[model samples]
Target: MKLVVGLGNPDREYRDTYHNIGFNAVDILAARLDAPAFAYDKKSNAELADVALGGKVLLCKPQTYMNLSGDSVGYLSRYYKIDMRDIIVLYDDIDIAKGVVRARLDGSAGTHNGMRDIVSKLGGTGFARVRIGTGFKPNYMSLADYVLSHFSSGERDLLKAACEAACDFTEKWIKGEDWQELTVTVAR
Candidate 1:
């Protein structure tokens, strides 16, 4: 089984925020695969769905919230007996340019608190991460406010494209393609 987690705050208020890019990507993936509706699972503290692809069961989770994401991820990971290598995390990256996607096999959380919490609970950064760039916010706005803010009209179109690209790269990654090749293909 492969576990694909999208990190985001789960609330109506966070629906279209920059921090919810992960959720956006997962939605695209689910739509592409015609996956079933996501229902909230109390035990996992996430909206969960399941689908089969490439002979492996794919478990999707849009965690409860960014700060408490590890709770759901750890729960699902343990329940499914999935190894770190079979896990993929998708989230927004402020450092990269908008409309771009980056994939990494394993790495520190960098500046993302959600990733940090996941690493802490999982005991390591041995899983894969797909980062969809949201672009940097202006210095005038606090990081919290910036991340929770909605994307501008112009940014929305770019974000939509980026989300689709992220989903495509995710499918490739799950299929055991080279990380570099996936990145290069999405970067094009």
Candidate 2:
């Protein structure tokens, strides 16, 4: 079985925020794949949707917020006995330009607190990752405030396209296709 996890806060207020891009990506993928509605699981503290993508795949949206995302990921991974190599995480990256989607097979978490926590819990960085860019934070705003802010109307379309591209990238990963060097950048 393969696991695809999206990292974000669980609050309604975070629905369209920059930090919630991971959740947005998974939602789009689920819809495109005709996956069933996500059901909340108390033990995992996440919303899960099982979909068949080349095989049995579990799409997860962790509800432990950004900083503590590792709790849900670790529990679910251990419970499912999923290999670290078969796991993939999707999340937002402020360092890249907005509307860009990038994939990496294995690496350190960098500056994302959610990814950092997940890495810490998993005790390894062998899993894959897909990052949706939310653009760099402005010099005037704090990182926390910027990440929590919602995307502008103009950027919304770009984000939607980016999410779709992320879904394609994820599909490639699930199918064991070449996805390591793929980078998708939406037109402005």
Candidate 3:
């Protein structure tokens, strides 16, 4: 089974925030697949859903919070006996411009605490990740507050487009498309 984990805080207040873009992307995928409703999984600290696409089974997780994402991912990954290579993490990145999506087979956590925790628990950075840019905030604002805040109207539109592109990239990945081609196609 392939696992697609979307990292974000779980709370009504975070519903439309930039940090929740990962969760939004997962929701888009689930919707496109006509997947069943998500059920709360205490062990994973996430909302879990299973969907079949192009003959592959996908396990989706919207982790409870950014910092604690690793706990959920680690539990589910081990439970399903899935390799880190079969897992893909989706999250927001402030370093890139809005409406952009970048994919990497493996890398350091960068500035994302969520990715850091996942690497710490997984024992390495051998998993794939899709990053959706949310644009950077001013130095005066706290990172936590900036990510948790709602996007401006313009940003929201750009975010929506990026999420759609992310879904397309995911579909290509599932089809065994080359990463270079997938990245180039999605970047457009």
lDDT tens digits, residue span 82-153, model 2: 999999999999988998989989988999999999999999999999989999999999999999999988
The lDDT of model 1 is: 0.84
| Global lDDT scores for all candidate models | 0.84, 0.93, 0.81
Candidate 2 steric clashes = 0
Off by more than 4 A, model 2: none
TM-score pick, better of 1 and 2: 2
**Could you tell me how far off, in angstroms, the CA of residue 113 lies in candidate 3 after the best superposition?**
0.4
What would the per-residue lDDT of candidate 1 be over residues 1-188, giving only the tens digit for each residue?
Answer: 88888888888889889999999899899998888999888888888888888856465564557987888888888887889989999999898778878888898899999999899888899999999988898899999999999987867878888899888878887788876534522332
Question: Clash pairs of candidate 3?
Answer: none
Candidate numbers, best lDDT first, in rank order: 2, 1, 3
**TM-scores for every candidate against the unseen true structure:** 0.93, 0.98, 0.92
lDDT of 3 at 62: 48
Say which candidate scores most in TM-score: 2
- Model 3 ranges with Cα > 4 A deviation: 181-188
Expressed as tens digits, the lDDT of each residue in 14-131 for candidate 3 is 8889999999998998888787898898777789888777655565664547887888888888988889988888889988777778888788899999999899888899988888
| lDDT of candidate 1 at residue 12, scale 0 to 100 | 82
